[model samples]
Target chain A: MGAEREPERGAERVVVGDKRKLRLATASLAGCFGCHMSLLDIDERLFELVERVDFDRSPLTDIKHCGACDIGLIEGGICNAENVHVLREFRSHCKVLIAVGACAVNGGLPAQRNHLDLGQCLQEIYLTAPDIVGGKIPNDPELPLPLDKVHPIHEIVRIDYFIPGCPPSGDAIWKFLTDLLDGRTPRLGHPLLHFD
Target chain B: MTQPSILLDGLPVPFVDGQTIMDAAMAADIFIPHLCHHPEFKPQGSCKLCTVKANGRYVSACTLPARDGMEVENNSPDLNDKRRTLLQMLFVEGNHFCPSCEKSGNCMLQALAYELEMLSPHFDQFYPNRAVDASHPEVLLDFNRCILCELCVRASRDVDRKSVFSLSGRGIDKHLIVNAESGRLADTDFSWADKAAHVCPVGVILKKRSGFAVPIGKRRYDVEPIGMQVERLAARSADEES
Candidate 1:
């Protein structure tokens, strides 16, 4: 895909090998991955997307860790230490970092726990539930420790752009990417900015 | 008699003598972003989202009366940046978790943030621990989502003639207080029929048992933005005039 000649600049159709496919990295921190699904909802446009960009560390490519990349699209809020580390890594590796979806931008649903004690919350879900036989809040060293409150990605690192929605609509994502690729600042307006 | 005019973003907007800049803009199908100014109620100018440059000076459009030949800038980059900062402050000052909120799709605050392209909350989340008042049998008051627009305060006092709601405290500590001696909605005579019950633009004053009935994607602001309806109304009036 990288070897393919870039799209002709204008009507002259000049071959430019200097323009390589932009590398993109994506990650799901504490979200449901609905934004990733929305990206896929671009449907046949995914073909066009692949022609213009390559995935580095993303669920699509199954790449474990991000290397140097031009763009990083992060979905979800920071709910644990692992999210903070992953976010920091993305910030260091990517030239442009985007907070995609409500979770990444504003802590969304997971932040409902911000009002309650984290330990009490775990107790209700694990130890105190009536249906549980021997349920316990996992204290395994492998598990990441939960933060006191859910935090949006911007609160932890610099986000160059944001795509707002529970999961931003396919059209909104498409417009944003195309605008960015075309070297235009993406602006979400009527019909594209629905919160649901 | 010809209606008076105000130059909003350089476009002439015709309005009655008593109408503010916001009212004139709405009358002309131009949306001036606002939260505290409702057409059916007196303008409060508290939220300040509708602030615009009038004659090169900033003024709340909701309260500033329109005058003939007055120039107002509503959509400039500088004004929008200011509005965005104010919105960010509102977001961090309250617990506005839109995904889990029953008012998620319908919330004016969420819709305004989306309309303004607010990239993020852009500040540390205060995560204020406010309590919910479920004492009223038919209404629920969740203090977490209040932006202090005071729509309910005005509605209860002016429209319902009940005076059941009022703003208390000051600055960051300020909040909505029930009028009853017990400081509970149940202690007050706030009912389903009260104007206050329907005035809140956020999830603060929700009618019990009617939540999620319209579904997530089908709510009022979900289908169209908060100001679109007013714009449509303006368009209809324009059509009538033409």
Candidate 2:
């Protein structure tokens, strides 16, 4: 090895002379769309971001399938079979993968059900909870099978970075993205590192 | 008699006759990073967050009495790494749910994690089935967030003289329980004015209807790191004694 540094796995080198824009994708699994809302909170700065980045397989683009991309931000936990499939596919498509928000990082609010029996939880909601008449648990092959427990994305696939907030502030996301673009190790310190 | 001292992270820290390593460290405005070793209460050394190497042996700094020439490694990388693991273990052991928690920014456990730069929970969450005791009209005891530090137990017994709280069961099954036969907070004499009512380092014991009185970003730990805040408090106490 000479003076040159090898790029880390999932970290694509952005050469100064390269003219191609970076491809970015995002996916939501078992979470509220709050993380994406925070991403949109980037607001007008997103217009400036598109000048250097391209969106693929994201709610922003309304694309159902993820294509090969430079970075992928996955929100929410793995709570169902579909989430697992989507996460694995997303991981394969992106060079860099980030677990965004508390859900992606540590299974957030959805994980409150982790201690409960999934079957019992379903039963309580549909059959027993309150005023209910002839409630039945839906069992359709078209519906995604729910997992026994909600798990953070890293428990299922490798995650390059973690933004640890319920929904990380848009400014924090912007700082992390700009740091990555500038070839610096992304660090969320002080106010930005909040979990809530 | 000459005051004994310990070399804490290569820095000389003086201690009086009966003060522990934590006492000396706090007196010197040095942070040892602890959860259960509150200055107001007697040190329990239960959490083990303040584990430090004293003369080549690991000991809880909060409980161990300082000796002259004792070389302690407090902030070593290995120790901090261990501390990070401890923080992660604590996070996964409980249903922290910081976003939904009223104690988010004011919580000591969350603040300590941020101070230690804990990025993820790092292990599969245990997420043990727990309950919230909202029977008390003035207080709420969410058993989900307890780290089993027993600060509340000590505070209730020693300070408030209520003995309203105790840890029951054993091993993985160990849990906090109320003193009343009915097993509810409302059945006990725990008032909002009690020391035990306010000693929780996490979000377990909370005031009813007082959630989110302070905005998210404006709370105690959000403004600055825990180390700075603890040190400032220590310095303020030292100034008061003089």
Interface RMSD of each: 1.8, 1.0
Per-residue lDDT over B1-242 for candidate 1, one digit per residue giving the tens place of the 0 to 100 score = 67678888878888887888988888777888888777888888999999999999999998998889899999989998999999999988988877667776667777788777776788888988888899999888899888999888998999899999998999889998899988899998889877677767778988788667666666666677766767532111111212
Top candidate on DockQ is 2
Any idea what lDDT model 1 has? 0.84
What shift in Å separates residue A141 of candidate 1 from its native position after superposition? Answer: 2.2
Error of 1 at B83 (Å): 1.4
Q: Write the per-residue lDDT of candidate 2 for residues A50-104, one digit (tens) a residue.
A: 8778999999999999999999999999999999999999999999999999999
TM-score of each: 0.89, 0.88
Worst lDDT window (10 residues) for model 1 chain B? B233-242
By TM-score, the best candidate is: 1
> How much of the true A–B contact set does each candidate keep?
0.82, 0.79
DockQ agreement of candidate 2 with the native complex: 0.64
TM-score, candidate 1, first chain: 0.91
Return model 2's CA RMSD, one decimal. Answer: 6.7
TM-score, structure 1 vs. true? 0.89
lDDT of 2 at A92: 94
